[model samples]
Each structure stands twice: as C-alpha cells, then as structure tokens.
Target: MMRKFFLVVTTWLTVSTLFLGSMVMADTYWIDVREADEFATGHHPEAVNIPYESIGERIGEVTGEKHADIRVYCRSGKRSGVAKATLESLGFTQVINEGGVEDVLSKIAAEK
Candidate 1:
C-alpha cells in the first residue's frame, strides 16, 4: 500500500511540473500597431501588424486569448499606447507597450 501511494504521488508531481512549465512557456505575441505602409517599410520579424485604428475591430483576429501576453509597438509611442488601452478595455490582461519600431527592435535584440 505504501509503495503504491508513493508511486502515485511521484507521478502526480511529475505531471504537475510539466503542466506548469508548459504554461510558463506560453507564446508571447509581438504586435506592430502601425499602418500598412509603415509596417511594410520595416517591422519586427515576429510581430504581426494590426493597425491601431483597427485594433478594437480585429482584437480576436490578432490575439488568441484575453490573458495572453502581448507586446505592442508602432511608429511612435502614441499608437502603441492607444492599442494597449484598447486591448485592456477589451479584457486583455497582459498588454505591454513596447514603444516605437526601433525601441522594440532593441528590446528584442537585448532579449536574444
């Protein structure tokens, strides 16, 4: 009986650890809240362009879940700030404003 209980506990712990690790490694989306022209000029390799003006309308199309971590940037801080606000209002809990294109690029480079 004791051996069986120990085996169950060990299995539970291993499964729990794997589940938590996967959650911690969830994808973080990089979004560029710039217009098509600006985005076409240049954007982060991992970023998806969702123009600031259309953020509210395309929220579902851009993000997978409300609680997903999202990093946003634009031509200037202004648009990203707007996008961040819109996302929060729409129930997104982890929207981060990464400022302009250059700023985000530097940040991504630093992370690497």
Candidate 2:
C-alpha cells in the first residue's frame, strides 16, 4: 500500500510539473487594446491594437489560427484588465494584463 501511494504521488507530481511547464512555455503576443491614435503614439514594436470595444468582434482576426499567449494593455489599464478576462474566457492559454501603454513603454525603454 505504501509503495502504491508513493508511486501515485510521484506520477501525479511529474504530470503536474509537465503541465505547468508547458503552460509557461506557451507563446506570448502583445495586444494593445488602445485606440488607433493611442496605439500609434509609440507602442510595443510587435503589439497589435484591436481596441477594447472592438475586441469581441476582432479577436479571431487578431488571434489567427495559431494559439498565442497574449499580453494586453490600454491607456489606463482598466480596459486591459477586462480584455485579459475576456481573452481567458475565450480560451486563450495565457493572457497577461500589462497595464497602460505608457507604463509598458517606459518599462521597455528602461530595460534597454
């Protein structure tokens, strides 16, 4: 009984580790939920702005067929938070709320 319990625990641990690791390895994309003008005012080089109000209608177009991890942001962070939840509800593997565009841009600038 002790041996079986140990084996089961080990198996469970291994499977959990692998599952978590794969989740961490998922691809991430920067999705800007700001308006076109805001997005144009210096954004992440690779970010795609679909705007918060338009996200539901444009999610499929922006996301494409391939699964991608998403980092969402807006002018004030509020929209991005909502967008993150929406993306999660829509089945995105990893949707990160990156807060406001200015904050993110500053962080990126600082990193360089």
Which lDDT values do the candidates have, in the order given?
0.89, 0.82
Per-residue lDDT over 1-112 for candidate 2, one digit per residue giving the tens place of the 0 to 100 score = 9999999999999999999978866656788998899888878898888988877778887665335777899988999988887776777756778898888989999999
| Model 2 vs truth, CA RMSD | 5.1
**Could you tell me the TM-score of candidate 1?**
0.80
Superposing all C-alpha atoms, what RMSD in Å does each candidate have to the true structure?
A: 2.8, 5.1
**Candidate 1 clashing pairs, residues 3+ apart or interchain:** none
Highest TM-score: which candidate?
A: 1
User: For residues 33-94, what per-residue lDDT tens digits would candidate 1 score against the true structure?
Assistant: 99999999989998888899899898787665887889899978899999999989988999
Q: TM-scores of the models, in the given order?
A: 0.80, 0.69
**Which runs of model 1 end up more than 4 angstroms from their true locations?**
2-21, 110-112
